[model samples]
Every structure is written in C-alpha cells, then in structure tokens.
Target: MFNLFKKKANEIACPMDGEVIAITEVNDPVFASKAMGDGFAVEPSNGKVFSPIVGKVTSVFPTKHAIGLLSDSGAEILVHIGINTVDLAGAGFDILVTEGDAVDLTTPLAVVDLEYLKEQEKPVTTMVIWTNSEGKEINVQLGKSNAQTVIGKLK
Candidate 1:
C-alpha cells in the first residue's frame, strides 16, 4: 500500500496522437492563460482528439469545447481542440465523449471542423498541462513530422 505512493511511476502520455506543432516554454501564468501564449498546442491534421493517458473524463465544458481529463496517474490534462475556437461558442465542434466516462489512450473525445475553422482563421491549440505544478517535473518528447505523426510524449 505504501509502495504505491513511493513509486515514481507517473508517466503522462501525449493527449493526442499527432506531430507536435508547438510546446510550452514560457513560464508566465498570464501568458499560459491566453489562447496563443504558453502551453503545447498540436494541430491534428487528422481532426481527431485522443486521450493522452488512461484517465476519467472529469469535466466537459458547457460550450462543448475543452475537456478536462484526470489520468489514472493523477495528471489533469486540458485538451482544447482549436485556435480561437471558443469564439465559435460550440459551433463546428462535435463531442463524442461525456464527463465521468473512462477513457483509454486511443479514445476519441471530440472532432473539430477544420474546414470551418480555417474559414474563421482559428488556430488549433491542444495543451497537455500538469495541472498540479508545485513539485512536479514534466518531460515532453517531440518528433519531426507532419501533424499526422505521433510526435510528443510526456513523462
């Protein structure tokens, strides 16, 4: 029982299976909150959002935009599917999963209308964040390829 907490085995995987387009380098709280500032964003050319780690769907925003996932390893990841997409106010977005659902690494959570998003000039920003940042260290592995490629890993 004690060994469970003693083990340092918390490994958070990439939320989406896609090549990384952006990563979080800025450490400012203000910048991180903005739509186009800090945090990692992935442009999934495939238009599908996957669970980065095995966790419960904690919260699905009322707008049907962003999703909050709590990994079994205790990592909370926020997956925001597109850039300026919140402006759409739930338009052009289709959510397949709901809150409290158990999800795997390959479960499809939502789909963004890329064609419609492009018409609106919204950039997709998919962020995998360590919601509890006080004493945690996050390592993200990235690959060089198109958005279709699996490029980022978190550990």
Candidate 2:
C-alpha cells in the first residue's frame, strides 16, 4: 500500500479575465438597472468564465445565467455572468461545466457574448459574493492598474 504522492491542492483561480465591474457589498441592489434606460440591462463582453476557486458547482440556475460554487475552504461564491441573462433563456452563451463538478484554476466554465449584451443596454456587473461571509476574510488581488482583476484569497 503506497499512498504518499498526492499533491496538496491550491486556491482556485479568478473566474473572469476582465475588469472588476463590481464586487459583493452589503447594500448591493437586487437588480441592476440600465445606464440609459428604465429597465434591467446587461453589457456583452467576450471572455471565458473561470472558477475563482477549486470547489463544487453547487447549483446552476435553470436559466444557465448564474452559477454557485462552494470552495474547498467552505467559502460559497456566486458568480452572475450578466444582467438579465436569465431572460435570454441560455441564448448567446455556452456553459462548459456542470453542477457537482470539481473545477480548477484554468478550467473554462463558459463563453460569454459581450457584444450582444452591450447592444441590449444591460449592466455587465460581474458579482462575486461570499454567501458565507462570516467564516473567512476575502481579499481581492489587483493587477497593475489597467487590467481588472477579481482574484480573492482567504486570509
């Protein structure tokens, strides 16, 4: 019986490779409003949605619009791709992963259509919320200054 070669896992990766449009706060609005209109909106941007941490896909909403990830460290992160994307009913989107699946840093979970999202006047507010906020302190890592980074580490 030889069981001594397992590599210790590391923290998960950032989900999106774009600017940090928004982060989870205490007073976040229930719904995002359009910048120029009186309705909910979302802006389309092309990018691969990645897993912020190594965890299980707890729940993938029926609309394929949002995903819930439970990190190995017991931090629950909810990643909402776009505004009102649920209304699109899975249009202009491609989901590469599924629920209960273990994902790593480089795993491509989904492909987003940002152009279509912008034409619709939607607010592309990528939200990263810790459902269990009392357990861990989340700190976001910022890149140089131009690139938007949403990477968070447990401290």
Q: List candidate 2 segments past 4 Å from native.
A: 1-12, 21-28, 31-45, 143-150
Candidate 2 per-residue lDDT over residues 8-90, each given as its tens digit: 24343456654443342212356332111111111224456776666778988777777788777777777777766677787
TM-score of each: 0.74, 0.71
Misplaced by over 4 Å in model 1 are 1-9, 25-39, 144-155
Question: Model 2, residue 13: displacement in angstroms?
Answer: 3.2
What is every candidate's alpha-carbon RMSD to the true fold?
A: 5.8, 6.9
lDDT of each: 0.62, 0.57
C-alpha RMSD (angstroms) for model 1: 5.8
Candidate 1 residues 17-102, lDDT tens each? 45554454323343256433234655455667776666789988877778888777776777777655678888878898999998
Q: What 10-residue stretch in candidate 2 is worst by lDDT? A: 34-43
Candidate 2 positional error at 29, Å = 2.0
